[model samples]
Target: MPVARLSPATLSAVRVTLPGLGVIAVAVALSLAVNRLVPAVSPLTGAVVLGVLVGNLPVLPESARPGLKWATRRFLRAGVVLLGVQLSVAQVLQLGGGMLLVVLVTVLTTFFGTVLLGRLLGLPRGLTLMVSTGFSICGASAVAAVEGIVEREESEVATAVGLVTLFGSVSMLVLPLLADGVELGMWAGASVHEVAQVVAAASPAGAAAVAAAVVVKLSRVVLLAPLAAGLSIAERRRRPAAEGGRPPLIPLFVLGFLAMVVVRSTELFPEAWVPMTKDVTGLLLAGALFGLGSGVRVRSLAKTGPKALVLGLGSTLLVTLVAYTGVRLLG
Candidate 1:
């Protein structure tokens, strides 16, 4: 048999750079366009939608897969770094004594509530906890940490994350409007997930709301250690003989993120450099979101679309209503 090989043109066509770059471009464009058209939806959410669509559909050639994967990984890593730039340790301290208590209570309540709701709806225990934790704490990090101890299948984690992303996006739009109408700054703070999403959503509510929401979100993040530790213990008890080989320690990036805040508060980095740091962080996060969207399979999302949508929407409504009521009474 004669040996055959790919031609130069064919090899070039197989490269992922073009398609990956194209997807990023499209995502940014779509996000901007959607923001203009809807005004209510955040550009980040729109970008996520665009990324998912481009990644899932057969919009690119197989030859580009390598490039796409590389791009996605780079983006994700950058996003994590960008996320660090936004932190300020002084802000956490400024939240005051009672504010921290409120955040702690809400996080615990939401975490347990989501899990209980999932179980009542006949969701698997592992999936229930994964979704609950992701919603109650930080998004991707919560999922990653829980996955280490839970031993659930990858599909379950994906399903939970997909639910969080879908619902978290919805919250980004809905909560801001609710906050505006109800003047529930504290509620908005206690309810929203990611700090960036909260700020983007609450920007319309004025700077005070944005500041409050960020404080609340960061306070929730501080619970990650105790939450992870408790979960690890529970997981070990449940598995007994499974030998999970020492529950993975809390990730270092989270500690780094907190440390960056401390550095910022202490003026370790000059004030003039802060803007540059934030800009870099934003770019990194945008790249990460792009990568995350690209990795999603449209078919899988479609298959679970109804369930994810319903769960996410329902959870948002529940959280908003409760938080709004609580904040109004307490604030």
Candidate 2:
């Protein structure tokens, strides 16, 4: 029998990685608990908050660092891949060409405008991109997708996610109070960062408005693949030497996302299984955000200056105005 040789480095790596996985599990559990108690705040948001708390507190040990980092990258990508199951090509098309155009314009403008403004403000590109995607697309989920491509620090991701939650929560309160239900619905669909925020904002407008808002929001979500592809291309252009030549047209995870969308369109899961799938996907994403959050240091984020806050506020206003214009013209 041939003797087997094992490398000490590989053994050490496994030891560290396992502990990190455990840390992620704990964060996921905490997120679930928070979401259960506070339905208004999603598990994804709760996870990030809890991760920050755990990181700052004495609860998280140094040994868990490797696992936390793993969760931040690998888990986030996995969650995003699963996100596609929640969307469908057919659903996006059903929104009608006019409304689809409105969504497209809103997403594209918000994305590019945010990037331009971030440059003007002298903010870091990674942080700016994260905030833009979070605000422009689907909040935390979009942040995760962009994070995978740009590979920013955990604190930057936290900052972007925090901004999204702050404004999205505000929309829930402010949009409903508007005088015109139709306008409120359009604004919510067009401007709000998260699907939950959109629904909360538009629900008061009644079922019809709620239905329209969801369809419009889904149309925006469908653009995530294209956005990721564009960003990947841009990233390659900015750092061709480091990144090594041209990037793939679509990332593997994004391809997985598109595949899931196709699978969903087939309606193979049956209606009863859809909710279960969503629940599972939510859990995975929440855990991933939690992992990202744990890497954040509150002090470091504050040190980055108020430009992030300004960028976030600026992006929010841009999307809101653009969305409102499109909705008025098309909705």
Candidate 3:
């Protein structure tokens, strides 16, 4: 009897990719559980930690590497694109002119400032770029988005992820204690690394603070595509003149993200579905981060030196001071 046979190409692709993807799926599930139980670190952040632990502990099977690579590149990009569903043009504009300026200035300053500091500290350009995105934008999501623009070793990516997650989580505890209500909210919205961390930090103040912080942080989130596109352009320009290739003004996935933002602005999606969409987006992002995390070598990242650490601390301080100044000036 004759039996159906899988094509060699298809079979080979699946053999290489499926195992790592399955591992990522499990990591995402674990992340969700941690999110529910712990409620401090974000599921995406948790997933990265989980991946790091698995990766550095000698448990990572070689068979899963191909899928991990696929997830880090493809899944991360797709997740960032889908994240746009949670934002809207109107939502950002409603923060008022002063708050808008604050968000814009904070992101730009933190981004460029970190890169310059990285140069001064002699950190690798690619690692600095990744860390800059994490600090200037929306933490891991921003790191994942910028990953498309700056090609680098996964170890660098992992290092950036670790720094942001550590600082972001710390801020959740420390920021609230520094101020109350609107003051704390403004500070956090403008300064905190991730949306989840912003919420956690600001919620202690009040619901009103949470509302303000979420809006402010989302404004930062809105900056992701533009910043990424700017990097892509700059990178293309910096290439040797002989290369002669002009990159797209925006990545296709970034364009998709912008489209999702527009769709969201129209308010066509049912309000009821927004929460569910956010959950799905978080899951996708978590799975991607887990894959990225599995590539981390803790010892290798350590050898890259304390320069990246200084950069992270400096970036964090820069944003915090800038955000506080904005809060005072704008008020």
Candidate with best TM-score: 3
C-alpha displacement of 128 in model 2, angstroms? 0.7
Query: How would you encode candidate 2's per-residue C-alpha lDDT over 1-331 as one tens digit per residue?
Result: 9998779998888888898788788778877787678766878898888888888888888898877787676777777887887787887887677778888889989998999999999888889898888888999999988886785777898888888988888777777776356667767887899988888889888887887788778778888888898888887777767666555657888898888888888958575776787887787788788888887898988866588878888898889888888877886
lDDT score of model 2?
0.82
Model 1 lDDT, full chain set: 0.63
Q: Lowest summed-lDDT stretch of 10 residues in model 2? A: 240-249
| Best-fitting candidate, scored by lDDT | 3
**lDDT per residue as tens, model 1, 52-75:** 666678775675566666665565
lDDT of each: 0.63, 0.82, 0.87
- How many residue pairs clash in all the candidates, one count each? 9, 1, 0
Please give me the total number of clashing residue pairs in predicted model 3: 0
**Please, what is the TM-score per model?**
0.71, 0.90, 0.92
Task: Note each model's CA RMSD in angstroms.
Answer: 6.9, 3.3, 2.8
Model 1 sits at a Cα RMSD from the real structure of 6.9
Kindly report which residue stretches of model 1 are placed more than 4 angstroms away from their true locations once superposed.
1-39, 124-130, 138-183, 194-197, 200-205, 221-247, 329-331
